[model samples]
Target: MSEAFTKSMARNIFFGGSLFFFLVFVGLTIHTTRELPERDHRENINEMVVLGKKVWEDNNCIGCHTLLGEGAYFAPELGNVYTRFGNSKEAIKGFIMSRPVNGIPGRRSMPQFNLTEEELEGIAEFLKWTSEVNTANWPPNIQG
Candidate 1:
């Protein structure tokens, strides 16, 4: 081969690299699409779950708690709260309902949000739905 650099060589290198990356991207897309059904967790979605998510967002729960490893860590991880609370929706509801409206003195507490029974149930259902998600063993422990 000649020692001289040429425009054709530069063009070939650029085109070759671009083609290699493009193929890799396409392969990854195909693999993800093929596996997406197994990961189709929308089966857990329901009216109550949707409403619960609404409540979660409306109340700004993320401001204090983490969900699926997102949001603040000031509070406990609620992603697994359903399981952590013994997988009992009633218990979760009760915990929320039992909170003092104005909060307790000298204690970092969750204030009462005055949610209706249905709303409370919805939130519980949402948390339950969240708990069932496969997080690849995230939170790293049962405490989460």
Candidate 2:
């Protein structure tokens, strides 16, 4: 009931707040760990998908486009690109293959990567896998 602030009271408040927040952090980490496997659908990963991921990294695709909201904003979000491409791997491949070798005049354009058939297939499979992940309605729209 005393109006004067005391050192013991300040210490208790600081320790109490820290403990509460620490517990909350631990709880959140546990929850994320439990949910990640189900949401990520890791069981779907295959050889092709692995190869595709390697190609993506080698090509620095993230440098231009985003995957799952991570990467540069210069290009489009490719996390759901498989779905956006009408759920057809061929369409995805076609789009990539169709890009002009030289960019458009005074406009942004995706450059042709000259990927082989196998690489194209791998990338398509990887994109398909990403599309199937349970992102909890990420991108908030179909455009992504």
- Name the 10 consecutive residues with the lowest summed lDDT in model 2: 100-109
lDDT of all predictions: 0.89, 0.94
Pairs of residues at least 3 apart in sequence or in different chains that clash in candidate 1: none
- Residue 91 CA displacement from its true place in model 2, Å: 0.7
lDDT by residue (1-144, candidate 1, tens digit) is: 566768899899999999999999999999988876656487779999999999999999999999988999788899999999999999999999988646457767788899999999999999998888766777788797
- Tell me model 1's lDDT, rounded to 2 decimals: 0.89
Over 4 Å off, model 1: 1-17, 100-107
Model 2 agreement with the true structure over 41-92: per-residue lDDT tens digits: 9999999999999989999999999999999999999999998889999999
Q: What does the lDDT read for residue 30 in candidate 2?
A: 100
TM-score of each: 0.77, 0.93
Cα error of candidate 1 at position 9, Å: 6.9
True-structure RMSD, every candidate: 3.3, 1.7
Clashes of 1: 0
